[model samples]
Target: MKKISPKELHERMQGEEKVLLLDVRVEEKYNEYHIEDSQVLCLNIPKTVIFNLEERDELAQITKEQPIVVTCTTGNSATKCADILDGLGYQVEVLEGGLTAWNEYRK
Candidate 1:
């Protein structure tokens, strides 16, 4: 799967490039922290749900028009989620190093 660095994502959002973020972390973790910006639309769908979901409509929040960045606490789960999204035909990329890397990048 493709990967996007936090710096690249931050630049894209800052440039007003609309982005869709599929955060595969649990809702509680997602609520604790997540990417937020005017140009970003984030969706909190746990990795477990994405793995077991059968109906496509359940993922209606995602669209093919925009490239999606999948994220988790670490990059592992996001990579798995990206593979699933790829199979489902979504334009997907994983956030490299996931949110941990992002936090470090910001620091």
Candidate 2:
């Protein structure tokens, strides 16, 4: 797994890179605000409960080879989810500073 800064993420998106931008923040927060209109698809799977059987089962739909970038409110939770996904043989990256950094970078 790798850590990508929000600015780097923005640049990648601008370049139309294919990535799976996974938002690990809770659904409510995700609904309230999120990264909009990027080259990648953004899916919300709250980190707090991702380890649950249902969540992991739902995530099984994503292919193993897909490049996935996980984000949370502050980046800590993203790291955890990244580790989980990496252990499961998925290519994973952590969004440095998470959505907070993403919002700051957009500004």
Which of the numbered candidates is closest to the native, going by highest TM-score?
1
Candidate 1, 1: how far from true, in Å? 0.9
Task: Evaluate all candidate structures by whole-model CA lDDT and list the values in order.
Answer: 0.89, 0.85
Q: RMSD in Å for candidate 2, one decimal?
A: 1.5
Best by lDDT: 1
- Candidate 2 global lDDT: 0.85
Number of clashes in every candidate structure?
0, 0
Error of 2 at 101 (Å): 0.9
> Could you estimate the TM-score for every candidate?
0.92, 0.90
Q: Write the per-residue lDDT of candidate 2 for residues 1-107, one digit (tens) a residue.
A: 69999888878887756668899888999999888774878898888667775557778668988889899898999998899889988899999998888888888
What would the per-residue lDDT of candidate 1 be over residues 28-88, giving only the tens digit for each residue?
A: 9999999888899999888888888774455887777668999999899999989988998
Candidate no. 2 TM-score: 0.90
